[model samples]
Structure formats: structure tokens, C-alpha cells
Target: MTPEPNQLLRPSLYVGALVLPLLMSTSALAQSAGGDWSYKIAPYFWGTGLSGTVATSPALPPADVDASFGDIWDNLDFAAMVVGHANNGRFGFSGDLQYFKLGNSGPTPGPAYSSVDVAITNKIYSLNAEYLLKTSSTSEVWGSIGARYWSVDAGLNFSAGTSPAASARSKNTWVDPMIGVRGRTELSGDLYLVGWAYAGGFGVGSDSSFDLFGALGYQFTPTTSGIIGYRWLSVDREDGSFQYDVEMEGLMAGVSFNF
Candidate 1:
């Protein structure tokens, strides 16, 4: 169902101000390039703020939305994300999964209503196939093609509601085709630089979508490392009269395991 766009909270996607490096060390992945297969997994946290315009139906004009990192933190009910990568020879693949829930409550006049509550949940997934375009003992560059999927659910409920004052819910889902390139190189012993960018949509699903990332990684052991960086992501979509333009920017941190 589509509901009126009401300055809904937006989580934006990943990517940010500093070309956020990452917890997943691509340099480590580069070091593993060979005839044998290698794998890595990592979990990430993004302290993000979001801004944009949204409309459930063109019947109503789009509304501006601005959500600060602090506001999101206060209403966030849950969040989780995991990324995995595997490669053999010059070919490989990667997958990412993320989920988040946000909620808000407001008091209302008595008599018929007491309070109103709003809840929003989001789920996202991406899968990509990769091919090495350049490689060295300490660095590598890859070309990739992928698909991303998104699902959003929003609902509102009122307490002590009278006749016709019920609850409402809205849900939306879509997929986008993407292409991008990423690479990493050792800066010095045990330290590396990484970055990647991708674009999609093109009217297939959304009108347009983009993601950017960069980071520095530190390897503490053969199988363990960590990273910190900034990231930014944005997407524009329209379904019938519904349209949404969303942008997310934030800081990122995470740990990775290579094997």
C-alpha cells in the first residue's frame, strides 16, 4: 500500500564524506589472488544522516525530509549488516545484507485518542560478480556487475482510537541493476587503501542510484583486520505517482576476517 509521504525517516544507504575506507581489506583479498579460492566476511556500522524528497503519490507534491544522525540514533529500534566475498583465480563474487528499524511516538489530545506511533523497517541486499582487471603483489583492481534489492515497510497506529480512526501501513519493494569498479593497494606494511563506486537504475527499477566508498585498513593477523571511513549513497525512484529521492551520508567502522 502507498501512503502519503510524511517526512518519513530515511536511513540513506552506505558511503560518505571521507571516501570511507572499510573493514574488509581489499588489499588482503589481493594478497590471496591465485589459483586457489579465498574468502572474507565482515560486519559494518554506519553512523549516517539522511536528506531528500519523497511522495507516495504524485497526487500530492513531494515533501522534504531531513534526518540527522542523532535523530536516527534515538529512534533506531534495530540495525544489522554483513558482507561476504570469495574469489578464485581472477574471478570472484560478493554479497551484502542490511536491515534497520526505526520508530517514533507522539502524544495526542485525550477523549478519543491518547497517542500515535510510527514504525519503519528496511531491508537491503546486493550480490555482485567480479573480474580482476589489474593485480600486483600488494594491490588489485576489479570490475563488477551486480543487482541490489530493497524493501521498506511503514506503519502508523493510534491508541484509544474511535470509529474510523484505525491503523495504516505501507510497503514497497524494488530491484536495480548495477555496474562498478573497485581496487586496493598497500600503502605501507600492514596498511592499505581501498575505494569503489557504482551506479544503477536507468529506469529499469529506480530512475537512478549511486554508491561510493573508500577506506584504510589495518591487518592485525593473517585472518583479522579492521577499518574506518566515510560513505555516501543516493537513489531516485518512481512507481506510478509515487516517487522518492533519498541520500545517505555517514562515518563507517568495522572488522573483517579473511580465510
Candidate 2:
């Protein structure tokens, strides 16, 4: 069933209400330096575990997964991730790209099949426009509005033993609206911290979603830093024959290069 219009409008309106004050403050702090933008690029790694229920095909029932990074690594095919940021005075923009693939094979419980093979892949992209809320020599905070695009594919093949071999595959994609805050501060000489939290969806796109990350960094040089962090992400949505309600969390490591 389609959602009521009001269900969608309410969250957007709420986001607007909260952002109004931030806009006012940003205007007060707006500077004339439009051409003096700074940029940074961070390539990151997340060793994550996925836990929850998922249904990729209408012909299959939802399955509960509690796969650890180790479990996934056993069958991992490829993975890549990077984040980029650009700032001009009090205004900023950020983007992230991440993708990974996994394949596994195991014995089946039922006598009809001798074994089961599975393949899964995920791709995510995020973009945000932000305004600096407060800034100082040692610390800075920003408010942001963003969107995340998610695409997932899953496939399974059953080996014939007592029954005929069969295969099923499915793919789905969606985008979610997000709003949140992010910041960083110096802890001591050559040491610093960074993180961000965001919540969105509100039935406008998916049902709901949330993302959070925190990290500690060591400055290697004026233009480079190495960071270790933890990240938690959750997304829930079921449209038509597709369902993906899952949470992912684990260790994160990265290097940030400023330019």
C-alpha cells in the first residue's frame, strides 16, 4: 500500500523547522571567501558484521543473518570505500562511496539438496551539503542534510540430489533522505577526533535509517592523518517483494589527506 501524503510531508517539514535556525546562524557567519575552498579525501576500511533479517526474492522466506567480518572475509571477493570533503567558508559538501561482494557455499540440511551456494553484493553512495555551526582553533561542528543510495543483489543456487537443481536471484535499490551533525576536535598535540551521526527515511523513501561513526586520529604530517574508529549503521525497508532490515557495526580505519 502507498503511504499517506502527510506521512511523508511531516518529516520534511520537521527537518526544515530545525534547519531554519542553522541557516540564520550560517548567514551571520557567512564569509566573502568563495574561491578559497579547502578539500580532503579519506580512503577508509570498515570490518563490519551484518545482523538481522533479509529477503531478496519473493520465492524465498526472510533469513536471519549474523555474519561476522571473519565469516564474510572467508568468501569476500572485493571491497572499496572512500570519502571526500570540500569546504568554502561556512558551507561544505561531502561524498562517500562503498562497495563489496561476498560468495559462500555450504551443505544443505534438507535431503532434496546436497549443497547451497550464495552470492551477495552491496553498493552505497552518500552526498551531503552542510553548514558550519561553530568553529574554533581546536574544534568545529557542522549541520548537514544528505541522501544515501543503496543497491543490493543476492543469489542462491541449490544443488540437485534428490530434487532438481534450482536457482533464485534478486536485486533492489533505494535512496533515503538524511539530516545530522558532524564534528571534530583536537584532543592534544598531534591527536584529534572525528565523527558524525545521521537519521532519515521517515517513510519518504525507505522506512527509516540511521548512521553513526567516531574515530581517533594521529597526525602524520600537516597534510595527512591516520584514524581508527567504530561505525554503526541501520536501515529498514520492505517494498513489494524485497525486504532488507539490517544493522551493521564494526571497526573502521582510514587515512585522511588534505589538499
Q: lDDT by residue for model 1 over 1-259, one digit each (tens)?
A: 2222332223323422111233245545666654577878877876555566544533223444566665656554555567777888789887777765655555544445555565656677788999999999989999999999988675656566452344656677899999998888888789988778999988888899998989899988989989888777788877765555777666777898888
Runs of candidate 2 exceeding 4 Å displacement:
1-34, 69-72, 103-118, 158-165
Per-model root-mean-square deviation over C-alphas: 9.2, 11.2
Give all TM-scores, in the order shown: 0.72, 0.77
- Predicted structure 1, TM vs. truth: 0.72
Task: Give per-residue CA lDDT, model 2, range 129-241, as digits (tens).
Answer: 99999999999999999898888886767778788887778888889898999999999889999999999888977799999999999999999999999988888889887
On lDDT, the leading prediction is 2
Q: What's the C-alpha lDDT at position 2 in model 1? A: 20
| Residues forming the 10-long window of minimal summed lDDT in candidate 1 | 11-20
